[model samples]
Target chain A: MELTAPDRHLIAALEGGLPLVARPYRELARGAGLDEAEVIDRLAAMVDGGLIKRLGVIVRHRELGYEANAMVVWDIADARVDDVGDRFGAFDFVTLCYRRPRRLPAWPYNLFCMIHGRQRQAVLARIDELGRVPGAAGAPREVLFSVRRFKQRGATRLGTAAAAEAAP
Target chain B: MTTFEKRLLDEFQRGFPLVERPFAAIADDLGVTEAEIIETLGRLRDEGMVSRVGAVFDPGAIGASTLAAMAVPPGRLDEVTALVNGFDEVNHNYEREHRINVWFVVTAPHRARLDAVIAEIGERTGLEVLDLPMQEAYHLDLGFPLQWN
Candidate 1:
């Protein structure tokens, strides 16, 4: 959908984010020349439309003192994938879970998940529990632990600054 | 597009100040009121154009695991997704254009358990689960300009 001027303005602002304040919405509304209710309404609509998936705090696991992390990939039977993926998603420690097409030659994972914890042991234990899950009884899986953080930031549309700068 | 949208994207990429009045601070810098900043964010969020506006973190900091993917059969996409998402450790899964179509990330506290989970998945799913542990992260930032129409 072609975003309206107001919509574009809103996206640009969100790309930056709300200021940390007691009443961030009210403050933002005033600056953007819109009412707080409008802002809320727009966000609600965007979320409903799937333009924006969710609005929440991006927890900095590292800053919060989480130390070790890894990525686990799974190849489950096509028939029982639902049963297995659902079981995987049910775990409290598991943070993310989704399905993607299995890559060949170079990669081969059909199902994916992310789990987090305070220590490597804790994370591993959770993975162990997933292993025992009846749904994933015969699925193949892989784990890629993060060695370093290359870059991290909340999602952003890259070239808005240049576009904004180039604007008259 | 208006200046508000431009500034929002630019400022967002740069970083948000972690202060008591972070929004107000941004407003002061941009010569706008804090309310404007919040409203704009709310609007963008509503429009389904952006995913999140919060802290970005290194998964490794917290004992977590992650991975990438390849082709999944067309027929069993939903089933595989359900099984994969079932794990709490699973986060950030997406379908990429490749032979190994299905890609996902998993994080666990320890290595042994992660392996066992992998083993279990192989046994249950009956697919060759290729474990591509991150040998070296050359570049890993997906946040990019969304101006490509």
Candidate 2:
């Protein structure tokens, strides 16, 4: 996407996260040298253009008492992955579900989902229940528990200067 | 949890206002002053309950990204992990309890650059990298109910 100077400035301001104030756009506008309405308009436009996804609060699952979390990988039959993924994703406990390419002779799982709970046993019990679900029944799966988080951050914004240089 | 905090968590997971004064709109909906709403949000962030009040961009929408894993020897875990994190493209790194102990998401401005970074990580660490690119996301939106017990 071709970003104008104000667009770049707006993104730069947002990259640090929205300001905590009664008038966040006013704060952003001050930093970006744009009008408060322009800040809102540009952000709304970016959301529409897929440059920005939904503007919402990013909660810390572990801190919120969801201590036991597992990334479950399923090796379902290739033909049935899409159907199975959809069914699994609909479950309230499943936070994330996706289909990924499996690397042969090393990684054998293609479908992945994340489940979180207050206790390890509770998470396991939920996984067992998931196993009995129609589409997931009898599918080979492995659970990888997160031991530690090394880093977690929002997406990196490509500076407009660099983006402009890359553009034709 | 305070009623104000509860309301903030419940109501603002998604669909934040897109208007001239979003906090004013939120304050009106939640029946609180705009200043109070902003203070609570600030406290939520400072307490590590909230990461950000911003957009979570779609993966691979603004850049190329892939899930990569490495099986590092237990003794060399720190060394290899530091090597991987040295790259600016690496984000969301974690140590999982599995043979493939280290996993991370690498994102770059383009696919070719992303591939090159993955290859370079393999060369630097001397560990086979399993590059798993997401084919489809069944649940693209990640906000879920946060139950505090």
Best by DockQ: 2
Real interface contacts reproduced by model 1, as a fraction: 0.06
TM-score of each: 0.49, 0.88
Comparing to the true complex, what docking class would candidate 2 get?
medium
| lDDT (Cα, tens digit) per residue for candidate 2, span B1-149 | 78778778867877788876788888899888888888888887888778788877666666578899988889998898888888777867989999998999886667777789889988987889999988998876657767767
Candidate 2 TM-score, true structure as reference: 0.88
What interface RMSD does each of the candidate structures achieve? 14.6, 2.1
What are the candidates' individual DockQ scores?
A: 0.06, 0.65
lDDT of 1 at A49: 60
Fraction of the true interface contacts (Cα pairs closer than 8 Å across chains) found in each model: 0.06, 0.71
What does the lDDT read for residue B70 in candidate 2?
Answer: 88
lDDT of 2 by residue, A1-168 (tens): 556767766775676688787678888998677999988888888878877767878777776777788999999888888988888888899988889998988999999999988899989998998898776799889999998877776645443445523622
Quality of model 1 by C-alpha lDDT: 0.55
Residue by residue across B1-149, what tens digits does model 1's lDDT show? 47766566545543444344556777788888888877765665555344345423333332335463434686876777677666544555655434455666655545554577567666667766665554222122323232311
Q: How accurate is candidate 2 locally (lDDT)?
A: 0.80
lDDT values for all models: 0.55, 0.80
